[model samples]
Target: MQLLAQVLVNGVLLGGLYALMALGLALVWGVLNIVNLAHGALIMLGAYVGYYLFTLLDVDPFIALPIAMVVLFCVGYLLQAGILNLIARAAMFNTLLITFGIDVVLTQLAQMLFSADYRTINPGYAGANFMLFGITLPWVRVLAFAVALLLTLAMWLFLLHTRLGRGIRATAQNLGAARLYGVSPKRIYALTFGIGAALAGGAGDLYGVVSQINPYIGATLTAKSFAIAIIGGLESPLGVVVGGIFLGIVESLTALYIGPTFVDVASFGILVLVLIFRPNGLLGSTT
Candidate 1:
């Protein structure tokens, strides 16, 4: 029973980070209607940014997070404004192809610059842990989870209370209506994408502190993010948190009982079930 409780705790913590990882992808998809295949690549870049900041400049990963976000925001803004805007009127398939191409290019660039070596951001206290109610909790994971939840809440607040947030929601609902309200769709779209990338960068920063990262990890991360986004429902930020926690718990249980190898099978199996039964997501409604 103690073991089970510990596992559950671990799963919940893992879920927090998972939710952060998927938030950006969900945001971009929900707002821009652009299924950015390069979303994961952007995440990889952020991880590298955090990694280098920690290793080269001796900056804390937590402190380096905003720096990574700012850099990725610029990258995202440029990509959306300079390239994606030109193809805004293109078909969904074309957009997908273009984004996929961007993903490939980013992956190659990452491989060339960082190599295929697995790297992790190891702070002085990374290995420290504290016992709580018979369960051991690592400081790094705890901090990562806290940051993740904080960012998720911050994003939710941003979407609900801010002027730009309303503009983003309006644009998602109807581009024409948003335009009439003096909301420039082009600027909003770019800003939305930039915010998405910034969120990805933040997630990646935390991820590097807790996991091994390499260029090739992007594809797998992208798949997991998509699964979480769909399962949680893109209707609201809370949905992603729910989905991430659900997946994290499922994966943890599967690893403990069925074997570690079947974790993906269990996760993806649940995703398939959710897709069939609740196409709108567990927390989302069909519009």
Candidate 2:
């Protein structure tokens, strides 16, 4: 029973990070209607940025997060404004293809620059942990989880209260109305894309502190992000948290009992089942 409890705690902590990881993808998909295939590649880049900041410049991983986010935000904004917007009015399939091409380019570029070596952000206190109610929580993971939740809440508040947030929601509803509201479709698109990339970068920064990262981890991260997004529903930030925690527990249990290799199988399998039964997600509506 104690072992089970420990696993559950670990899973919940991991879930927070997963939720943040998928938040960007879900936001972009839900609002911009752009299934950014390069989302994971952007995440990989963010991890590298954090890694370098910690290793080369002696910046704390936490402090380096904002830097990674800003860099990715610029990249995402430029991509949407300069390239993605060209085909914004085009077919959905085209957007997917273009994003995939971008992913390939980014992946190749990262491999060229950083090589395929796995890197981790080993902070001074990375290995520190404390026991709580018979379960151990690592400081790094606890901090990451708190930050993830804070970011999600901030996103929700921004969407519900801010001017630009309303503009994003309006654009998602109707491009014509969005334009009528004095919101430039081009600028809004860029801003939305930038926000998404920023979230992805934040996730990557947390991820590097917890695990090994390489140039090729993008595909897997992308797949995980999709699963979490679908499970959480695209309409609400809280839904992402629910979905991420759910998957984290599921993956943790599966890794322990069903063999580690089956973790992916479990996540994907549950995703398929959820799609068939609850197409809108556990916490989301069909609309």
Candidate 3:
């Protein structure tokens, strides 16, 4: 029972992290209607950025997050404005092809620059942990979890209370009406995509602290994010959190009982179930 409790705790922490990871993908898909196949590549780039900052410049991983985010934001913005804008109104299938191409290009570029070596960001307290109600908690995981929730709340607030946030929601719902209100669909698209990239980068920064990073990890991360996004529903930020935590707990239990090999199988299986029964998602509307 104690072991089960520990696994549950671990799963919740992991779920928070996953929530942040999927948030970017959800944001872009929800607001910009861009599937962003290159999302994971951007995350890989962010992990690399954080890794370098921690090792080369002695910047704290937490502190380096913003830098990585800004860099990816620029990359996302340029991709959207300079390239994606050309096909913004094109078929969703076309967007997928373009994004897939971008993913391939970014993956190759990262491999060329960083090599395929698996690297970890080992901080001074990489192995530090504390006991809580008989469940051991790592400082890094706790901090990452907190940061994830904070960012999620900030994202929700941004969309609810800010001018640009309103503009983004407006554009998402009705591009034509948004333009009538002086919203530049092109600029909004670029900015929305940039924000999504920034979130992915932030997640990558936190991710590097917990796991091994390689150029190839993007594909798996992208798949995981996709599953989480769909399961949670793109209707609200809270849905991402719920989905992430749900998957996290499920994965944690699966790993404990069935072995880690079947974790992905379990996750994707649930995703398929959700799609069949709840096509709109756990929180998405039937309409």
Candidate 4:
């Protein structure tokens, strides 16, 4: 029972981070109707940015998060405006092809620049942990969880309250109508993509603090993010949160009961089951 309790806590923390990771992919797909294959590369770039900021500039990883987000936001904005915008109305196949190409380019570029070495951000208290309800909680993971939840809340509020947020939502629902109401489809699309990338940047920063990262990690991260988004349902951001937490807990349980090596199998297995039974997603309405 004690071990199970500990695993649950750990799973919750892991799920929080996973939620943030999938939120970006969900946001872009929900808003722009574009499944960005390059999202994981963007995440990889963000991790490197945080890594360098901490290692070279002596900046803290949490503090470096916003900087990384800003950088990726610019990258995302540019990609949407300069490249993706050209095929905004193109077929899904074209979008997939173009984004896949971007993913390849970004992955190769990261490999060339940073090599394939695995790196982690070790703050002063990397090994610090505390006991709560007889459960151990690592400080960094706790902090990362807090940040993830806060960011997710901020995103939820932005979508429900802000004017620009409304504009982005409107564009997602109907581009022609959004344009008629003074919302520029191109601009909103770019902004939405940028926001999504920024979220990925934040997640990457948090991820580096908790685990090792490499250029190739992007592919797996992207796949997981995609699974989370699909399982969470793109109907709302909260769905992504539920999906993330669910996967996290499942992975944690699998790692404990089965074996660490079977974690991926469990994660994907859950996804397959979800697809077979609940095609609309956990949070999605059947109607």
Q: Can you write out model 4's per-residue Cα lDDT over 65-141, one digit (the tens) per residue? A: 99999999999999999999999978889999999999999999999999999999998989999999899999999
Off by over 4 Å in 2: none
**Native-to-model Cα distance after best TM-score fit, residue 222 in candidate 4, in Å:** 0.6
Question: Each prediction's Cα lDDT score?
Answer: 0.92, 0.93, 0.93, 0.92
TM-scores for all candidates: the values are: 0.98, 0.98, 0.98, 0.98
Worst 10 residues of 2 by lDDT: 177-186
Clashing pairs in 2: none
The worst-scoring run of ten residues by lDDT in candidate 4 lies at: 175-184
Q: Report clash pairs, candidate 4.
A: none
Whichever of 1 and 3 has more TM-score, that candidate is 3
lDDT, candidate 3, 34-117, per-residue tens:
788899998899999999999999999999988999998999999999999999978899999999999999999999999999
